[model samples]
Target: MQRTLQPGQRCEVWIAGVTGESELVFTSDELLLEAPNWTLDGSALILNGDGKLWNFDVAGRTLSQVPLAGIPDLNNDHVLAPDGKQIFLSANDGHIYRAPLGGGAAERVTAVDGSFHFLHGVSPDGGELAYVGIDAGDFSQPGRLLTIPAGGGHSTLVDVGAGHCDGPEYSPDGKWLYLNTESFTSLPGHAQLARLRVDGTGFERLLDSETVDWFPHLSPDGDLASYIRFPHGTEGHPADLLVDVVLVSTGDWAAPLHTWPLFGGQGTLNVNSWSPDSARFAFVAYPLANTDSSKDHVRD
Candidate 1:
């Protein structure tokens, strides 16, 4: 099957039990909706598409656009505030903004020129935001894990050293920051999942294997961390590859508690998608068009 950017993408909301099978809560024909976050009240799932945000009702199976009037060019890096009252958005223009969760005009959060900032997670106290920032024109250099005041202030480099660091999510307890790091400019080296203190100390490598892991999302309870694993040697986080959503015990990252294989990557699990209870998550998977070259194949 050849994976085309056509309209075959299926956006799914799945609930994975701690000790049981995963169930699909919702599915739709809408394609390219990425990185969904559940509303705190658990009433709806919020996602981004076509440079705008969207809200999907879980019970009614209905979808509607979020009225972000003045903001455009939104990316998948947007995340909901810990309080669930605001949304942090990263635009293609390399700036970050925040808007009311209910839908309203967005306000600039970062005041930088020509710097790309990608939102990953907000602190549990709602005082700081964890993100990855890099030069807009430099793809060879790794992005630095950074933190700034939630209200907007000078950004602080997380001092994770050199690597393509991404997905800087904070633990529910606000004690540690978890993220993924790959070699700055090499393919032979594998991407590893890691965590460090918010003060830039206590760095530890949680998972290192043949698979390239990215975007580790800590459950609301802080007991589990779920992330998407790409095939070994995949240069970048490209879509349409055979990937797996691997869940690991936060206390013991030695082995994955469970692994669900799927036909999606990149857009899948780009941001934190854990439910309020932390038992379920939302992700996107694309169904490929059947063709001679696309026979249940996994891209490398």
Candidate 2:
């Protein structure tokens, strides 16, 4: 089902410094904008809104719809290619596609049967893609991590553990794939940040935290990282709840360098939005008016 803004709610796009406060870059009282992918040039953020793609200009604080032909409504799991000229899309149709960032018809990339693909990461060399696959389009089942040739081919499974995992993205050097998984604990829906070698070995938890961590996005320099933290016991990253966008050192995920509190979850930080220089990152917040009773879910 399509996501909708709650009554009297608004969407806010923000840019945060690694060690300073967050700046509101843009806002919309109606449009529901999801995951932002920072352009490699650092001038704009590409986002998905109203089932289409858009480029949110950082300087002008404006939006331009990306003309993508021959594709279904997109999900928040879109990823920018390492080349910067192309983007990989995960559509609601349960397939993936590759398209020019400058705008054109998207070429279908995922042809595998029996599962729905949710793209998360592109390899540093742009030769591969990392994504989560839901068997037979079943949202209730745990997503399995898989990789395939960027141009489309047979996928290879890269298992982390039994519980569900998401936001599998490659490090700058391409040596590791960072993600959030529930493999570390028996507690239901207790996802934590972790990583694994690209060769499918050396799986390690990046942090031990009480909050539910999802989407570990590394900066271009691989020195800094960002992720969204849900309150403890939250079953999956849902929308309209209060959450935190955290920045941390790649060397120490357990120690946060900064955290921005807001009212958002699912589409908030679903993809990497770190600027090319790694000084700042982008995220979205969906805040409802004070009168909305849903605000009661804000964690204490």
Candidate 3:
């Protein structure tokens, strides 16, 4: 089975189980395809693209684009509200905004100065939002993973002075908050996975890898996690982002369950949301090529 969609066309979600047939949910036209998100109840879909947030009705096949006034470009990290009615996005300028999925003005949730905000993920309960914020300093220390109320309130700092932590994802049960930390002097990709309590204590190392392991997304039932693994060396420009799926229980990084090669080369993969049933996930491929308007492209 196949579906036809243009570059920005909104369509239904095609689902294929491990051994069953594929099915479509029949959604409205595509509103914005930049970053599409699925609601918790699977009734609605939210998308953020080209400086706009859009809501789509799966059954009605309708699209509503929300207006975000006074907002700059959106950061890569964004989360959906637990109730599936709101979209939470992070700004590079150290602020988070919440906009209704249907269509309305977005409001600010965080207002910390000199901080670089990145959206990690939402809690399972949807009552709190988890994010990573770095102090606007010399960029020589680790960022802080914080928990804030979904409705809007003061932010509570969870981790402090860890040096280089990035990409925080909550476990399906919300009992463990996992993040990646690194000690590299230049690259944030030189990081590993660590589990921390919700209250910010009892930190334990889950896996250590010479390469970078980022964008940890737990499956719906909490059995597995899918992430992108970039190798350690760069041949010409930068290392390619390789897709990898791992079993959570295998804390020992001796071997991974399955590994696949992404077609794009010399680029990074930015993964955020996973499918509701955990059958597949979505990610963006960023090419790190140095080019001009007219130049020959080669695979180096």
Candidate 4:
């Protein structure tokens, strides 16, 4: 479901460290923003808000809209290209697009296939993209993982057990795709963190938990990871709910390095936000109108 913009809500964009330190960089009691992707040069973050994309300069602490001609409203599922000059965006129209990072006209990357593509990762070499395909735009059908050429080509279906999956992201080394899937259990909406070999073999869960985990994003160095944890029994990653932005070692996901309790759920950590050096990552929080979450707490 498309979550409408909450004009009365306060949108906060924060930068947090692996050591449990965090800083509020930009904020407004206005429209919504989601899925901030750090630039390769570490100068800024790109996020989608109010059905458009904006660039938040990290150093200047300012926000600016990214001008793209002829592109529809975008979803939170977007990934930066390995070249660092382009980005792949998933639009509300259920198609993926390629556009220059600075701002330019976008070119459609997906054919008129029967499925809607929600992009998550671009190969390290920038040759392919990984996304969850909802066949015929049917929400009741399980999402199938598919990889297509970055420039648009035939899609290859990846089997990840017969359950709905989201956030299929590629590792920096390009060997594995890390994501959340429900195949590990029969329970509905129970997404657990897992990884699959690029050849679609060796699928394994990173850790077992009752928490509904989604979107496992590894740092560029392959040492640290960040993901969103929804409350138990939550049907999906919905908006305006209490959740955790968790940081853990890629080697041991069972042990969390930091647990950030905040008021945002779905849009908070849906994409990779790690800085170029892996020292920091960005996330957004959408506090509900009735909640007093301004004094949110962080745990070590």
TM-scores for all candidates: the values are 0.90, 0.96, 0.70, 0.97
Better of 2 and 4 by TM-score: 4
- The best candidate by lDDT is 4
lDDT for every model?
Answer: 0.78, 0.90, 0.56, 0.91
lDDT tens digits, residue span 52-165, model 1:
788988778888888986665788888888778998988877778899989888898887656788888899988899888887647776788889898899988878867788
lDDT head-to-head 1 vs 4, winner: 4
Per-residue CA lDDT of candidate 2, range 1-300, in tens?
667787889988888887756778888888899999999888999999888999999999999999999999888989889879999999989999999998999998998698999999999999999999999999899989999999999999998988999999999999999999999999889999999999999999999999999999999999999999999999988998878888888888888888777889999999999999999898998887763322332222
CA error at residue 229 for candidate 1, angstroms: 0.8
Residue 135 error, candidate 3, Å: 1.1
Instruction: Return whichever of 1 and 2 wins on TM-score.
Output: 2
TM-score of decoy 4: 0.97
Per-model RMSD to reference? 4.0, 2.8, 7.9, 1.3
Deviation of model 3 at 123, angstroms: 1.8
Clashing pairs in 3: 10-30, 28-61, 142-163
> Of the pair 1 and 4, which is ahead by TM-score?
4
How high is the lDDT of residue 256 in model 2?
Answer: 82
In model 2, the Cα lDDT at residue 111 comes to: 87
Predicted structure 1, TM vs. truth: 0.90
- Whole-structure CA lDDT of model 1: 0.78
Window of ten residues with lowest summed lDDT in model 2: 291-300
List the candidate 4 regions with Cα displacement exceeding 4 Å: 1-7, 289-296
The all-Cα superposition gives candidate 3 an RMSD in Å to the true structure of 7.9
